[model samples]
Target: VKTTVSVIKADIGSFPGHSRTHPKILEVAARRLKEVEGSILIDSYVTHCGDDLELIMTHTKGEDNEEIHKLAWDIFMECAGLAKEMKLYGAGQDLLGDAFSGNVKGMGPGVAEMEFEERGSDPILIFMADKTEPGAWNYFLYKIFADPFSTSGLVIDPSLHDGFTFEVHDVIEKRKILFNTPEESYSLLAYIGAPSRYVIKYVWKRDGTIGASTSTQRLNLMAGRYVGKDDPVMVIRAQSGFPAVGEVIDPFRTPILVAGWMRGSHHGPFMPVGVADANCTAFDGPPRVICLGFQVCNGKLIGPADMFDDPAFNRVRDQCCDLSSVLRAHGPFEPHRLSLEEMEYTTLPGVEKQFKDRWEDLPE
Candidate 1:
């Protein structure tokens, strides 16, 4: 059966500050999805990564289906209302518009979805991140799909030898391009290396089977202001012709630096953590990512095993802490803080305006 897996997320509200999601918000989302589970959805799971509430659902409806989008929007609206009653921080912050349109793409929430025929024993991984942007997934996706060293299957396994194709999006230009890997891998890097602009939206196998999909919505760009980080989500189908679960997740062990930390302006290590530890605390985050493994059978989601909740990842967590300290020490300096061009959507422009009059031309 052709099943569509949709992972939609938004920061409707959180407790105290933008550190963690309120339990009540999650409860409301769960109850709301349950109401239409058997009718509209085949399966549903509601969870959170830091302040963002993620709704993972399976259905027969294809990508960007109006009914699926509306269901998610209505749930977020109800949750936002409850959040306001509880006086939660940033309540309804991501619901950019007053009313739900036919879709939620530009409305504020981050959506990553794909529809595919279910393979026998189809294993998939859902990655939800908080305190980061859609570009944050670029590094790992490259390593998983292109780099042979990162994924030995690319070199060893015959099924993966032919390589994959990446569907990259230029978020600023609102354009997309495809590059077949192992061949145009160099060309692909030239764009995706600059994550803030070019993001890998989807990856497909040589046979045209879908390998992965990521939410490429840039919230600041959509709202035309510094609302918050995009806090993206991704779905990667594992095993069979795709990379094994281990190969797909192995890249994150390095703890690479990504934009969106405190004030959504600083660069910090992207730390992998379990759902239980997926909250922003230090410096509003060293931006956290959580992976949940699932098996899709007959359009139903089963076994969301917390992939990163292992002792093996403890060393990387420590490395992230160390890196965070080093970066934070920079304190508003470049390489730690984003460049002026990237901060255009942020409040940096306003700060520059304040000092505009006092500034004089420096030594020519």
Candidate 2:
């Protein structure tokens, strides 16, 4: 039997200034999802990453199922109302549309979906990040799937030696292209390297099996303005032909600088934190990523093992904190501050436009 895993998430509301989700909001969502538990959805799990509420569900309805999408849309709308009742900060923040049309894409919220035949032992990982844009996963995806250095499976595992194909999306232009790994990796890197523009939409093994996939819609781009960070969600299938569970997670051991810090204007290290600690407190960030692992058996999600809960990741968290401090010291400088192109959605562009004519052009 085929099962479709749909992970649709959004920051419908946040408390204490986008730091975390309110309990009442989550409770409302849980109740709504439970209402459709057995009939509409085969199984479901509701969780949060920072302030964004994640509704992970499994169904036989296939990808972009209208019924499933509307179910999630309705739940978020109800939760947004509850948040407003409680005066939650950034209430109804990620719901970019007043009404749900056909689907949730282009209406805000991050969505990663996949449909496949259930294997005997299916180990899947769900990665949800806060305070960062969708493109933040570009680097990690490349390293995990393409780089033999990060994923030893590329060198050792015969199944993965065949390499993978990556689907890259130009989020700004709404264009997409595919590149085969080991052969066209440099071509893929040339685009994804400029993560602010290009993002990895999904990946597949050479034989067409899904390797990994990410939610690629940027809320800012869709809104044509800054609503909030596009905080992304991803789903990766591990073991068998793909990388092992450990190989899939090893890229996060060293903090990598990603766009997003205070006010969504700075570059800071992306820290892998436990799901329980997935709060965006300091500078609204030092962008954080939380991972949950599950074993799917007969369309049921089991053991949402907090992947980063291990003590081994503690040192990396400390290192990220240290890096955050150093980067914060730079303040308004480049390499710390995102480039002017990336700052288009921020207030900097408008502020710079005001002084555009007042400033004199230098003559060399």
Candidate 3:
């Protein structure tokens, strides 16, 4: 029997502000899953990314199972109804499509799951981020996948010697192009360095061993409007073949900044936070990411280690605190404001709205 773990996420609702999910909405989702658990799933866990709610399930159904996908879809719909009832901010925000058309891939919501011949004591990381888009993972992925500074395994581990291949997507074009790393790596970095656009959807070892994967399809790109920011989710198989858990987490400690805070617009340091920690102080964030380590065998989840809960990492959190205050103090200055390209979805919309009549041709 082959084991598989699926990490599916979608924004159900938020409290008045886009702070966190309403508890009752999560309860509805959990109850809906519980009713069908013994019949459709082996075991499961439910969590959130700021306003988005995620359902991580273990099953034999493999990727995009209709029953499994529908189970998640229905739960989100129920939760969306609760959001509407409560008149929460960004209610039913991630449920973009008119209906769940087979899979949730382009419909709305972010989904990343992989089925593998289970490795004994298989440890994996489940990462969920909010108040930002999928492009936010670009820097973290580059460090873990390509850079020697972050992943020493590129030299230490023979299996990693061949390096990894990257499939960079022109998310706007809905087109994908491939490049092999340690070779064409500089070219890959030139594009992916801009986190608001390109994102790493999946990564594999030189020998075809799965290394990392994330849902790449951004709903805003597909929806053609500010439907909501892409609250992304990722699942990584760690240790041994891939980078160790530290390599996977070290990049976050730098508090590397990205675009997104209030209205999914603004810049702030990326904070390495723990489970159930989703509150933006004043500027809307310190955009946050959480790691929940898990073990699976024969399609069942056995262990989940909260990766950020360590005394050694406390200083890094403090550093992020300082960076957040520094950036917040700037209060919408150049660089502190998002890059021009990213601004297209934010303030530019209002700026463009003002110029709508100016473009009217008189004598061209």
Candidate 4:
């Protein structure tokens, strides 16, 4: 059976500040999805990463299906309503539009979806992040799909020997390009290295089978303001022709620095954490990402194994803490804070305007 895995997420509200989602909001989302489980959805899982509420669903309906999108939008709307009642912070903040159109892509919420034939034991990983943009996934995607050092299967396993293709998106230009790996890896790196502009949107196997998909929506761009981080979500298939679950997740062991921390303007280490510990705290982030493993059988989702709940990842968590301290020490300096181009959506413009009249020309 061809099954579509859709992972949609939005920050409708959070308790106290932008640290975490309210339990009531999650409860409402669960209840609403449960209502349409057997009819509209084959299986559904509701989760949260920091303040972003994530809805993962398996269905026969293909990607970007209007019905599926509408169901998710309604659930978010209902949860946002309950959040407002509880007086939570930034209630309905991600619902950029007054009404849901045919789709939710441009409306606000981030979506990453892919449809494929279910293998004998279809294992998949859903990664949801908070306080970061879509570009945050670029580093790991390269390691997982292109670098043989990171994924030994690329060199050892015959099935993966042929390599994969990366679908990159220039979010600013609203264009996409495909590059086959091991052949154009250098060209690919030249673009993805500057992730704030070019983002890896999808990865496909040599046989044309889907390997991974990421939500590339830029929330700040869509809203034309500093509403918040994009808080992207991603889905990656594991085992068989694809990389093993271990290879897919091994890259995150090194906490790479990504943009999006406090006020969606600073750079911080991308820390991997379990769902229980996915809330933002220090510096309003350090930017947390949670991985949930699942098995799809006959269009149903089974076993959402929390991939980061192991003691093996404890060292990395400590490293992230150490890195966080170093970055925080920079305090408003470059490398810790984003560059001027990236600060376009933030309050930098207003601050620059305030001092515009006092500036004088420099000596020739």
lDDT string for model 4 (167-245, tens) is 9999999999999999999999999999899999999997889999999999889899879899999999999999999
lDDT of 1 by residue, 1-364 (tens): 5999999999999987999999988988999898998999999999999999999999999999999999999999999999999999999989999788799999999999999999879999999999889999999999999999899999999999999999999999999999999999999999999999999999999888999999999989989999989999999999988999999999999989999988899999999999999999999998999999999999899989999999989999999999999998999899999998988978899989898899878897
Candidate 2 per-residue lDDT, tens place, 1-364, comes to 7988999999988889989998777787878878887898888888898889999999889889999999999888889888888889888988989888979988887899999888889999999999998899999999989999999989998989989999999987889999999999999999999888899999999989987889998777788877778889999999988889998999899888998777788899999999889999988987999999999887888979999988989889999999988998897998899888888888787788888889988899
> What is the alpha-carbon lDDT for the whole of candidate 4?
0.93
For 1-364, candidate 3 gives per-residue lDDT tens digits of: 6556777888767875777887887777777777776679887888776777888888888877888888888888888888988899878887887677778778787888777777666788888887777878888888888898888988898877788877777787677887788998989998998766777877877667677778786776677677657778888887777788788888777778877777666777777777756555455666878888877766666666778766666787788789877877877675777767777766468777888988967796
Q: List the residue pairs that clash in candidate 2.
A: none
C-alpha lDDT values of all predictions: 0.94, 0.89, 0.77, 0.93
Error of model 2, residue 250, in angstroms: 0.8
Name the lDDT value of residue 355 in candidate 2. 86
Badly placed stretches (over 4 Å) of model 2 are: 360-364
Name model 1 segments beyond 4 Å from true.
Answer: 362-364
> Model 4, stretches more than 4 Å misplaced?
none
